[model samples]
Target: MLDDFMTRATLAGVGTALAAAPLGCFVVWRRMAYFGDATAHAAILGVALSLAFSMPIFVGAMIVALVMAAAVTLLTGRGYAMDTLLGVMAHSALAFGLVAVSFLSGVRIDLMAYLFGDILSVSHVDLAVIWGGALLVVALVAWRWSALLTATLNPDLARAAGIDPRREQLVLTLALAVVVAVAIKVVGVLLITAMLIIPAATARPFARTPEAMAAFAVVLAMVAAWIGLQTSYQFDTPTGPTIVCVVAVMFAVSSIASTLRRAG
Candidate 1:
């Protein structure tokens, strides 16, 4: 089954969705959408550095993403607006990454692949990385689920219960970096946060509990991945953006249904 490129691509997409949906729940709950973008955008710089240093792209992306996430976490609430901080760092990192990539002489790199993804060309090694990273993220999030929830819902309450909200934030920061590293291959940097945000957002209107929301987001995400791959194959459209488009459509439908249900 993995012999086929399509099979590999589908599995990669599903793996990415698996990891992204649950973490995306935290992202939505914490209103860390911009934070996600910043981490993802910084991944381009990682790609450049990886090519320059001749290391694995995953290692470079992971290292740079961790650094970016840590920087954002550290600088948050240090006398600047969150959006402003993210906007500055996010665009600057992307601009710098593009420039850095341009400076790598004799290397014919496809910026579009890193920016928008090249999922249809995924290989067995890629599958291993995607699923391995996905499972690791799932385990990490599950292990910290209760503590993370407590911190998110009420930091003071979490403190009263002996859970440090800062620690939980670090857990999320680490997880976000991992997701960005793994997903850079699947959806690329530009659209990684979309995969993270859309599934969780689409699942929100129907889920009454955090667990339910995460599960629904996973299902919605996998379905979007499958449908998006199929649609892209059928229409010869871009795979990464197509997957995001499908999820966005799901989000719109879910939102409309939720609105009608509430109205009725």
Candidate 2:
């Protein structure tokens, strides 16, 4: 019985790491850390709405994240300072979600669970949802990898090359929304950004190309997931935060190694 549970948990963790890996690469490439934070913050509202409407958490999060992404795109397209607008929207959504959750009287909802995730509690159905969503995201990203990279490297150049930057931005936004929704279940809203950023950052030193960077990022994220899970299980700590901490450690080690290599 214990072995069975461990197997299931490991499977779920692998699914999460796989999904996060590619998305994390894009998040780093485009410097979308704030955008990711915005989407993650909006996830709280999704959770609140899911409880209020008796819907699946994933469905609610995806819907809310897509809406938030669209709103950010539209607002920023109209000349708003990206940072200011994102900050307002992110904090406002989080505040509103807390207020919304407070209105529910009977059920005891631990906000921390949604904020930091409960990965060990993930069910088989959740794994299916994570893997299925991940596959879709991966397919879309793979198909548009070249165009996306072109845009990321030089938006003006991509535009000159007949690629529409706006359209590509929208595509990336949608991808990010899916990533945010799925990642919330793995690492929750507060820590989700760390998972996306840290692993990719750790992989940067070893990458000579965008594709290589992405591949390395995936490997780093998976390693962090495995190490983090083992640490969590052994130390009886929260799984999500432990994963973030592991990723952080990886980042620090990578940075130091890079510096040393440069000196040598």
- The global C-alpha lDDT for each of the candidates, from Candidate 1 onward, is 0.95, 0.85
In terms of lDDT, the best-performing candidate is: 1
lDDT per residue, candidate 1, 123-203, as tens digits?
888789889999999999999999999999999999999999999999999999999999998899999999999999999
Model 2 stretches astray by more than 4 angstroms: 1-3, 77-79
Clashes by residue pair, model 1? none
lDDT of 1 at 23: 100
Measured by TM-score, the strongest candidate is 1
Q: How many clashes show up in model 2?
A: 0
| Per-residue lDDT of candidate 2, residues 1-264 (tens digit) | 324666666666677777777878888888889999999899899989998998988889888988999999878857678999999999999999889999987767989889998788777777778788778878888988888888888999999999997888888778777777777777889988898788889999989988888888888888888888899999999999999999999999999999999999
Pairs clashing within candidate 2: none
Model 1 residue 259 CA deviation (Å) reads 0.8
Cα error of candidate 1 at position 7, Å: 0.3
**How many pairs collide in each candidate, listed in order?**
0, 0
| RMSD list, candidates in order | 0.7, 1.7
